[model samples]
Target: MSTTAAPAGSQIAEITSSDASLRRFLAGLPGVDQVGAEARVATLATRSIKTSAKAFALDLAIRMIDLTTLEGQDTPGKVRALCAKAAHPDPADPTCPPVAAICVYPDLVPVAKDALTGSPVHLASVATAFPSGRSSLDVKVRETADAVAAGADEIDMVIDRGAFLAGGYSEVFEEIVAIKRACVSPSGGPNAHLKVILETGELVTYDNVRRASWLAMLAGADFIKTSTGKVSPAATLPVTLVMLEAVRDFREATGRQVGVKPAGGIRTAKDAIRYLVLVNETAGEDWLDPDWFRFGASSLLNDLLMQRTKLRTGRYAGPDYFTLD
Candidate 1:
């Protein structure tokens, strides 16, 4: 519940002691050899959404991303307008909820952090050579520190997925752990929550995704994310399901509540709903809140708003009504 970011050079406070049953569930389970495709997949399909409750939860987790590429001379105008859309939830379509965070690159963190002030919505920045975690450790650390100093509430970093797949898990893990250490806010109170991007498309197999997710969690990842918006695959349900289950497993092991963010290519209410179902069934109710979950999207807000407007007023609101860039 503390707002202060964790300090640099600080050790990742292990969460394994979250709950006894949770640990028991997370402990010494089989590594890839222990799982079977037929098992969870069959159940995964059965639990897919069938009611409004499922749809409602999906809307809550979809966090909007306004890329830096989209912000030019009108950065302030764009940010203010973005905040307004998120703050004023349309009552007509109550189910299409406003986003939890507005994501951007480190340079724009202040712009967004300031715009989101006084609202529950948090400001997140992609740091450490995002979309391509190919940079010096010093640069990554500074990038993270600068973003936090600029008031970013969350740090989303790409996991050197290429290294991990090349059997360099140590490199990937250490970078995340190091970045996590470097992310404390200006107050030096608490470290910004770390979201490690697997760039699942690059990770390839589910086995690799599973391995990367677990490794990042072990090294202090607060959230396991899929793709950098620049990736070809972005976020797919199967890949996301793997990440969500990993969160559940990590929580069970460390008693820590990690969040899940499926970034890239998620643009509609239906796609969001499928992810909601995946989380609800795999992680349960404890993970439902915005603190523990989110969806990375760029074009979802307008669609959600249009639908909400339609559902509420019985009149369709055109695409121009929402400005989610």
Candidate 2:
């Protein structure tokens, strides 16, 4: 909850409104030290959790998951099934908490919305040419509108990493600004929360990850995401650790709260707990909630459920007890 003042006539105020000024503000931020960051993550990853604490972490990880299914062959049936599983992850055990949301492609938003109706599981759609981000700006905005119209509660948009890497920070910033404008209600209020994916795998360095995190936040991202799950090295500990630190710093500098999601390659209960540990130790306890932090993965939920079952039943349930989505 700490905040740094954005004084009048300061760079913070200018960057908060202008693309050119935002570019300079991001560029002027200090570079990240890769070795130091990696070492810190490595150390934090070793923190051990015993019985009750482990059980708490397991359930918390489940609630923070954005159970995702983004495939070329995705169908309505697939989305409906995913929504059911998202709402009641472990049907046998009412103690198992529901996931934060069910993420799907933009086209399947209606299907997911219908399936998730009357449930706490939110329907999130990946819009703006996800995974590749090769579409035009107009197409991106239109797609986002379609998803919102289809009843998507959240919109996850990928930043143009190609443009970002080429030093077209202004273009990238402008695109996010326009997309934020697109995520509006019929009454002109906020419609969907915007998650800007940096696709950290393609960004190439921790410094780039840090810069992209700030860029997305400054551009009005409700959450800064790590990857789109189509890229390799998606959502690594070092990368996510950097993003968590970035949100922590951004909140202090601007007094604005931005969430963080680390998607892809997080398939085990231990891995999910490691991420929660990072959030607690690095981002503080303030971000431990599902609204502030989310894990975007499909398989990770099953692992967490299995572990939850083990905690409740005094035995490991293995993977067979849970339905694979």
Candidate 3:
């Protein structure tokens, strides 16, 4: 697979499709000091955000959420309920902003789309054999196209970590390129935004996380995501910090800004605050927007709503106040 040019007028790093070139680029990236990264995240986690700052961070986190439901038991009713929650997370307070997107299975795209009609919230679908990229290239491409046809505004595709771990750098890069191509509409225009999931929990090291982040960015991922939520240790603070650094460095190198989504296991207002702190300090204030940052979570919204209620009402609100979806 030859290196393709970045979308017209977009700022993207120039990368050769050759395996040797890709290896050199990966090798040239600065080595991540795990201890240093961990220490930094710990220190940032301690930053005292209170009162107005805490309130701002709370709402920002809500808007940055990619509310998700990916399960074998999902039905249209379930998806519609999730979509309603995404549109109005807190019905008690109209001030609460809707989440950035509602993420679901490809087959549920139409269900979510119709539910989200007349709202700004986007519909996202996980494709390319989510949680495990153990399918053929043709299958992955077809899955992406089907999602787009069904009305998904974004596609979250998981990379083949088995191949990446096997030192198949070129294969991983080519796979990303192929899926990126598949994101185009049938009418020959841009379709869904592509988010490449690295499943960093399975990558096992900060160094691998950094490398995978760049590889996905080089292949034109609109966003680089961290997990699928099926594995343990998903979306840890240290892993997200490294990815934030990767996006920061990639922007410095190519002038193109790629978003980051830390999915799974991030379920509390405090946990969400820690991640917001990491983004502010490492990725800078520029990434504070929902467009550049997102949290892929299912149960996280309820917690955020509960906290928001506390902030507004001067007392903690029970879970019943928020929708159970």
lDDT of each: 0.68, 0.87, 0.87
- For candidate 1, the lDDT comes to 0.68
Give a tens-digit lDDT track for model 2, residues 1-325.
2122222333455776666676777777677778887898899899999899999999899999999999889999999998999989988888789999999998888888889889998889999988899999999999998888888879999999999999888899889989988888655555899999999999998878888988888778999999999999899998988888888887776678899999999999999999999899888999999999999998998888888887888888888888878
Highest TM-score model number: 2
Prediction 1 TM-score vs. true: 0.80
Q: For residues 1-325, write the lDDT of model 3, one tens digit per residue.
A: 1121222223233344478877877776677888888887888888878989999999999999999999999999999988988898887788999999999999989889889999999889999998789999999999998998888889999999999988788899889999988888776555889999999989998889988988898888999999999988789999998888888877776778999999999889999999998898888999999989999998889998888888888898888777776
Q: What RMSD value applies to candidate 2? A: 2.4
lDDT of 2: 0.87
Angstrom error of the Cα, residue 263, model 2: value is 0.4
Cα lDDT, model 2, residue 117 = 84
